[model samples]
Target chain A: MVIQDLKVLICDDSMFARKKMNMTISALGINEVFEAADGEEAVAKYKENKPDVVFMDIIMPRITGIEALKQIIEFDPDAKVVMASSVGTQGHLKEALRAGAADFLQKPISDEDTRAILENAAKGVL
Target chain B: MFAQFFGGYLLHKKLVTSEDLTQAFEDKKHTRMRLGVLAINAGLMTADQVEHVNITQQSVDKRFGDLAVELGYVTEEQVDKLLSQQPTEYLLLGQTLVNNGVLSNAQFEQAINDYKTDNELTDSDLEGSKNESLNKLVTEFYHLEEASNARMLTDYVTMMFKNIIRFIDGDFTPLEAIVIREFDAETLIEQRITGTYDAVTCITAEKDVYFEFAKRFAGENFGDITGFENETVGEFLNVVNGLFAVNQSNEGGAELTMTPQQFIQDKKISFEKPAFCIPVVFSFGEVDFIVSTE
Candidate 1:
């Protein structure tokens, strides 16, 4: 698929974070973008939209990004969920990967990092 | 990191007013680091000798480095070494103050020496942003050594300053920290850290100052948008706390996680234990960071 045609879902509790990432993703030519304020909403949106790529935050008001990732993966084993969180500690990293996260991104994630992930997703590498 | 602490030290000593610092931080971007200030900072030349060179330059058309060398104040090798080094932000602030006539050359020399001596910072420590040096600087600046959880406080504060410089502005003067059991906050974003240890951290400031800080971090004009300030500042706290948790987990094997941020306005929040209320002054206004190790 073309990179611009891919649908992206961003799950972060902070409105500022969500807005920032949404703008960046939209600027990258991805028109269909979804946002979730918490992990529960993230899972709901993932199942509803079945976006091509998902960017998730670790900590949230409801179930965390990891829990949401597990739910999405269970619903669709081929889900490409990227754990984009501020806390990429060893424990979280291991847990996210063990739970079937496709990739991990540390927060304050730059536009370049997001672009690379989207490109990889478009190429079916992630 | 050193630059912020140095600015703090200058403020503490009353060498310059907060207004002076605000102006200097704004002007420092345009201020070039001169060889005289560099040599004086390096202890290679006396202020009097630098002054002599400055006076001689009025008549003799020569570069400061060349003039200093010609006057036998600094050798060519020393001048080269000083010139080769990158001017640190703190030094540039100092240079700007000097250029603005806010501080004299002799006063700058004394303040620099006293600051280095008081903080026990060596030349190497001042040059680069080494973690050890920064931890030491933070510990000393905040008197964290006297606290029971000195190591954790040092690590957290050091990380906070680094992130403040990263996400926010570096042009802030960290004021002294006050211990308080409770605070009536005008606007505050509070988040809790749990797992190996439990602690509460908060960022609070006045209304306009809070908005300005959010604007700086978000880089957006969310004019009169209710709750936008909370979200923006909450995200900043979350990022800093998340990074701190990750650092602790990686370095000390201490598993830590942060709760979702809580936004409080015109409310009285009390801590179980005494919290360190660290106030930092920006060009816009003052903001307070409160941390409670519970």
Candidate 2:
């Protein structure tokens, strides 16, 4: 799949975080980008859109990102969900990886990091 | 980060007025660090010597370096070393103040020396941005020693300022902190850090200042983002608190987690413990950051 053809889902509670990531991903020429403001919405959106990549945040209003990741992985074992969170502690890292997260990005995620993740997903390497 | 705290120090000492700092921070972007300012900061030449060199340069065509050497204000090797060094932000701020006539070279010299001595900071400390030096500076600036959780408060405030410089504008002065239990907030966003310890962190400002603070964080991406002022400000608080939590988890082996941030309007909020209200005056206006650790 071409990079631009890869569908992306960004799950973060902060409107600002969602908008910023949406803008950055859009700038990478990825035309299909979806956003979910919470972990529950993230799972629903993942099932609905079947996006190629999911950038998830740990802290949110409803279900935490780790639980969301678990639900998504249970639904589709091949899902590529990256734990993009502010709390990337050793405990969180171990839990996220154990929950089948493809990767973990500490926030304030730079545009370059987002772009590289998308490129890797397009190449089936994430 | 040192530049911002140094500005705050000068404000506390009455060496420079708030207006002086605002103008200097604005002007410092274009102000090149000159040899005289460097020499004065390095303690190799007094402001009087720099003024004397200026006077001598008016009569002769020689450069300030040659004249300084001829006048025995600084050695040729010292001049070379000063010129060879990269200008730090604090020195640039000082140089800008000197150029703008807000501070005499002598005043800059005295303030810089006093700030370093009072904080027990060395040139390398300011240059390299050593974490220990910053912790000391933050603790002393806010008088966090009197607080119950002095170490945590110092670490959190230090991280807050670093993030402010990183994400927001560095052109702000952190005013001294006041411990208060109650605050009538015009606009406020609060987040709780819960795990092992419970703490509340908040950012509050008047309507206009709140908007400006939000704008700084949102930047050019959210120009048409109507009614997102609350979200923008809340995200800033969230980011700072999140980074602080991560730092604590990594260094101290303390497991910390942040709750989703909430926005409040025209409300009165009280803390279980006395919260430190740190008012930082940005060029746009002042915003208060409150943190309570229990």
Candidate 3:
């Protein structure tokens, strides 16, 4: 799989976060991108799109990213949902990994970090 | 960070108006640090001595450092040491103010000295940005030592400024904080930290200033996106509160979690306790950050 062929879903309540990440991923030459404003939409979108990778924020209005991650993994055990959040405390980190998150990134994610994640996903390593 | 607090100090002392600060912050980017300003900041030369050197340099081709040494104002070693040092942000701001004539060299000397002495900041403290010194500065600036949960308030405000500098612009002046029980907010986002202790944090601003702040954080013109201004501001509050929670959990053995942020517009919100409303003036406008530890 090449980087441009990857399908990515971004789940964040903030339109700012989603739009910023979308621009960066699009700049990476990946055209297939999906967005969700909360965890409910995230799970629905994940099941509908079955994106190659998901960037999920921990806090959202309806359901949290962690709960949505669990639902996605339950729907498809191989779902790649990375916890991209502000709170990367020990408890959140341990719980995210326990819920089978592929990776965890602290908030204020740089464009470089996004690129690295996509590269890993393309190589089947994320 | 010291630069920002120094700006705040200047504002508090009435040594410089907010307009002076705004202009100086803008002008500092192009202002080069001269040996005269550095020597005065280092206390090795008086403002009059630096003025004399400036006058003498107009007639002679000698550099400021050589003339200062030759005039017995500063020794050769002191001149070399001052010139060898890198210019910190605060020094650059001071130099800009001096150049702009907003502050006389004497006023700059007095303000810098008093700022250091009042905060009990050593030269190393100003240069190195040690956390202990920052905590002291925050506590002193807000008069948090007399407030309930002083330590927690100090820690939170200190971290807030750090994040503001990290994510937003560093060219902001933090106004003196005031304790308030109620506020009629034009635009506001509130989040709660709960667990071993409870606290509420909020950011509020006028509509235009709110949009400007959201624009700064989002790094885009939000004109096309409907409801983007509120969401961007809410996310900033979320990020700051989340980091504060993580810090508490890791260092203090206090497990904390944040409630989803709530956005309110043109509403009256009252805190159960007296919240410290810290108004920070950016080049764009003033935004108030309110925190109450319950």
Best by DockQ: 1
Give lDDT tens digits, candidate 2, residues A38-82. Answer: 999999999999999999999998899999999999999999999
DockQ of 3: 0.67
CA error at residue B182 for candidate 3, angstroms: 0.9
TM-score of chain B of each: 0.97, 0.97, 0.97
Query: Could you give candidate 3's fraction of true interface contacts?
Result: 0.56
lDDT of 3 by residue, A5-118 (tens): 999999998888899899999999999999999999999999999999999999888999999999999999999999999887888889999999999988778999999999
Evaluate model 3: give its lDDT: 0.91
Please list the residue runs of candidate 3 whose C-alpha ends up more than 4 Å from where it truly belongs after superposition. Answer: B58-61
Sequence-dependent TM-score of model 3: 0.96
Model 1 stretches astray by more than 4 angstroms: B223-225
Clashing pairs in 2: none
lDDT of each: 0.92, 0.91, 0.91
lDDT of 1 at B274: 88
Candidate 1, residue A6: how far the Cα is off, in Å = 1.1
lDDT of 3 by residue, B205-275 (tens): 99999888888888777657889888898888888888887888889877777888889988999999889
Candidate 1 structure quality by residue, lDDT tens digits, B1-294? 787788899889988999999999999989889988998999998899999999999999999889888777878899889989999998999999999998999999999999999999999999888999999999999999998888998999999999999889999999999999999999999999998999999999999999999999998666567689999999999889989999999899999888889999899999999899999999999999999999
Taking all chains together, each candidate's TM-score versus the true structure is: 0.97, 0.96, 0.96
- Going through the candidates in order, their DockQ values are 0.80, 0.77, 0.67
